[model samples]
Target: MEDKELKDKLLLSKLKAEDKLKDRILHQINAEQALIPKKRKSKRASKENYFSIFGIMYAVILSLGVYFYSQTEKNPLESNTFVFSVIFVAGSFSIYWFLMVYMNYKKVKQ
Candidate 1:
């Protein structure tokens, strides 16, 4: 009976220690979470988005202008307006995608 009582006490102490450890872990998690600031979501990307769009529009217009100007010349086949336009758009989009992925990875790592 004495041995059984000792075993019961040991089990009780073990359970209490586990509960304390769990509480400590939860407290630490909450404390760490409180230290980090959350990012505010913007409802719209107005200014930057608009300017990026305008820049793209301007590029397309400029490319068209170049293409037309080349058409009036005798060496129309030598003009690379279309190729440059394609390269510019592809490069811009790929860069944007890369930046987005990098930003997301950073956010997740944090």
Candidate 2:
């Protein structure tokens, strides 16, 4: 019937208009995203860089500990204390780094 045809045409027009509106909104969102500045490094990459730096620091501290231990004959108590302190610092840094890695892993998992 003509009435049914008119209703179908009206429904089709409504759908087309809705599709156009959706496209417009999507374009606007994309345009806004384009205008935003991108970060230089992602979170994972920066974290990796930080961990590498910590690794280097750990190696240096370890070398110093060995050197101090080697020189312990001159002043045993002083050298022991210095070596102990270095060991404590290295342990703390390692624990903290592992905790950070675990936290990142959990975050990624979620």
Candidate 3:
């Protein structure tokens, strides 16, 4: 190949590289905008999902209560630990379910 032609090709490649570098630098300068999370426009459906979760939680708790009750009957003097555990387990489930419903109502009113 001719020396002049080789020099022109090298110059073209250098220009392309410089253009790419400029774009990357500009992108980095405005990168903070993209880094910020986009706000959620609406979350009505998010309420329904929480309710479904609460429903499942209650169902599971009820099943657990039935199991524990039967077991305690089989052996009336199991352990203090078992009785305390059953009480707390049911209470936590109720609290969480109520919280989800309250949150759901508050969000829906918005």
Candidate 4:
């Protein structure tokens, strides 16, 4: 009876180890799936969602402003246009972040 009990405990432990290993393999597979970038889901190639004309204009203006600001006539970042441009970029990024969160929330609900 004692030997049978010991054998039962050993088998149970082996099953437990196998289950844990299986879970780890599944997790690894999921990680690999995530690493494989889904081309259809990527926004970078989407012309409709990618840089609009206004977005390009704003980006160009921001880039030029920042570049000019870095060149010393006076403190470049101190310029009102630079400050406003930075604010605009920050505001746009914040709005985009909120939109992403809201969209994700809606998706989760659905």
- lDDT winner: 2
User: How close is every model to the real structure, measured as TM-score?
Assistant: 0.33, 0.44, 0.35, 0.39
lDDT of 2 by residue, 6-73 (tens): 99888876733566898899999999786443322236554785678588768877777676768764
Error of 2 at 77 (Å): 8.7
The number of the candidate with the highest TM-score is 2
Report the Cα lDDT for candidate 3: 0.65
Which residue runs does candidate 2 get wrong by more than 4 Å?
1-15, 18-23, 28-40, 73-110
- The whole-model C-alpha lDDT of candidate 2 against the native structure comes to 0.69
Residue 38 miss distance in model 1 (angstroms): 14
Q: Write the per-residue lDDT of candidate 4 for residues 1-110, one digit (tens) a residue.
A: 69999998888766335668988999999997875565334434343343553476577666767686667566657788767876777677657756765665565445
Model 3 clash pairs?
none
* Per-residue lDDT over 2-66 for candidate 1, one digit per residue giving the tens place of the 0 to 100 score: 99999988887663356689889999999888655433222133335545755776676567667
lDDT of 1 at 41: 26
Q: Rate residue 27 of model 2 by lDDT.
A: 97
